[model samples]
Target: MPCAMAIWRVYLLPLLLLVLLRAFTSLPTQAAARGGADPSSGTDDGKHGSFSRNLLQDKPEITEEMTRGYMSNSELEIAVQDFGRRCANVSRVYSIGKSVNGSPLWVVEISDKPGKREAEPAFKFIGNVHGDEPVGREVLMQLAYWLCDNYLKDPLATLIVENTHLHILPTMNPDGFALRRRGNANNIDLNRDFPDQFFPINDDINYRQPETRAIMSWIKQEHFTASAALHGGALVANYPWDGSRDKRKQYYGCPDDKAFRYMASVYSQSHYNMSLSKEFRGGITNGALWYPIYGGMQDWNYIHGGCFELTLEISDVKWPKASELLVIWKQNKMSMLNLVASLVKTGVHGRIFAADTGRPIPGSLMVKGIDSKISASRTFGDYHRILAPGESYEVVASMEGFTPKRTRIMLERESMNLDFILDPDGAAGQTKRLPRDDCGCSCDDDGKPFLIREAYLWLYLLVVFFLLVLYLLFRRRISSRLARNPPKRPVAV
Candidate 1:
């Protein structure tokens, strides 16, 4: 009996040991199957021990069907290409530059008229400077498709494409997009990389990667008149003159300052519920490094490039669901159209000042000569008239207690630093003032007073005429001088 019991213990003990070893070996695999142990994960530290239990109890399954509704980077590219192919007349896909990962940086040029590219002012719509904020790209693609499909049927669409060139670069950071990250492949924030007046190169938190360089190069080459960069994680429309800590910063009211305010006001009226006057609040004040940013794209666009650029923070939450796309599309579509449309027609922009004091005059009317469109100066005494380019027109200013002053001008070139002053009507109680023609010279038989004609044209002709006459006179003088004083000839070569 003792020998039989010893035989049973040896066999059973070996089997028990083998079973225990197998169970111990499978523990790590089971832990990994439950999402593994990530020390840096936002979950609690002690939770690692119960990972397997929690995962089995609370894990949510992500089915393939759910993912089919949303777009990946590759899928988006294919869709863009297909859309371009369908609307061959109005849309064309071109490469802006190559991404760090060797993918072509795509730009879709959308216009209704095929042959009028150069004759139009271009409005650039860019998206996804931060790879994680991909909604902008989707919105841009939708805009392109809507414009192309509705060009013939929609009057506004036809007018916009015919008059303005729409350049859309859907994804600026393709590499970061592929990785589903905010920073690019090199871990650089493209927004903070722009070469601003503050920083020309990457320093501290500012890092310019290849993607930003490509964008800067494209902007320089294209010379876009107006543009907007789309961002996510905030629900507001941000405009330029952003470099100062406060809205009252000195640079905010500089020479081109009126232009910045006009841009901000236009964008606010079009899209978001916020006002340009109150956009700077909380910690995220205007464009200043008050938030510790070294360089930013919007500031660079305004200061360095002379193009009016704004940052449109389109969503209140990050990674917005697919359903929110259409809502955003509807909200921004008209505002975007209006911004581009305003650049067309004719524009009158000048400074108004007090006739007596030579100080800025606020709330004055600036009427376009050709279209007779009126724009009013803001409290800061700056005004801009949006009209058809390459058209000649006059601007008139009228204020209370001052004589009306008018200036004939041309909108062929971008005008700058135009200042005006109104004069008082005669002395204290003269009642009747001298006519404007008296000071300017005489009026024609048609009663039209001409202050100045195309003096440059006449001056150019006069210079050429004078030079030709002088050439002839100089030739005769030289011949006469030679007859009077002949030069001595050399004896030999």
Candidate 2:
């Protein structure tokens, strides 16, 4: 009996260990074979094609059966135009540009004063970056409709419409959506089409895809305070420095890292199940920390457009059933609203104007210690500087001709209004008045011009005296010069 027991322990345990190892190793192959999501994937450029990790495993490949009830491109266009007509008072529909297949990239600008530049922060939502990810496009359309239907009736909706210019691009890549693929008509990933900070893939202007060009142009035309591009196949809010400097997959954070983390948290904490995610802690991640991808839209918006942007992976499934879209919207509703409201509810918003002229000046805004700078709009001089609350900051506003003003504020939980009326650096110096109103709310009143008048009087007198002295000197010098060297007489007529 003792001999039999020893033999059983050795043989059975060894067999079991071998079988377990084989089963664990076969999991990926089994997943691939079942047409289920496998982490293995390749890029449109055909690089990194099979290095998908467990975290990146997607839903089974999208099929026609899955997209049966989804809106077609023609139907989407009609819907957008219809939305414009129904909500014309708070919305305007316009085309940013066309897709590769010449499908108009329709944008719904929602604001109390649509198509006008007011002293307000602008936010944009771009959906359908990937052709296969139809969830974002549908959900974004739902967002627009909700805002239209709830405006004035809902407090949050009313706040957004009256105080913010919200731009909704329901689909950025219609050709990709129609094809039901991961890329555009030319098969280029629109997300990777932007010029990367570390790579030269899209440096040449002419070489960019039409969809990428349109977005680049649109950002240039509008001074968006913040923007987000919606995506799926994951559920997390991603923030910038999408790639590391060394081209390694590591946590590469941008200058506004803290502020971005706060913004991302605002979305995750507001969501129903996002904060409960077991994969990503707190449902937020730095772009490079997740997986280093260059030429991404989020990083470009932050770096070039002065727009603080987030890449939102709002769904775990890339192509969810059409019926599931409404539920998805309901889950992400508060997140979307809170994110837009952050522009007005948590930021330092104000206009920069010339004190003497009272005209809006296109100025750049910078926090005292932070390296990054956001610019005010050229039309309205309005700038929105979103920051984490409960901290003191020295907000600096500067224009080329105006004296840069720096004022410190103890920002509480709510947003603070800090309008800066900068005097011309030249004017302040010429007047020599009281260190140029370098402190709090001094420009609120031009009530007393007496000091300016006194300074001007002295300046005028000094200029006149100098000019009279110069004239006498010139007379004396001319008389002496004529004695030394006679002036040439008119010789030829």
lDDT of 2 by residue, 87-185 (tens): 999999999999888999999999999998788899999999988888888889999999999998999999999999999998998998888887799
lDDT of each residue in 133-194, candidate 1, tens digit only: 77888888888888887897887788777867788888888787776676688766677566
Index of the highest-lDDT prediction = 2
Q: What's the TM-score of every candidate structure?
A: 0.55, 0.76
Q: Pick the candidate with the highest TM-score.
A: 2
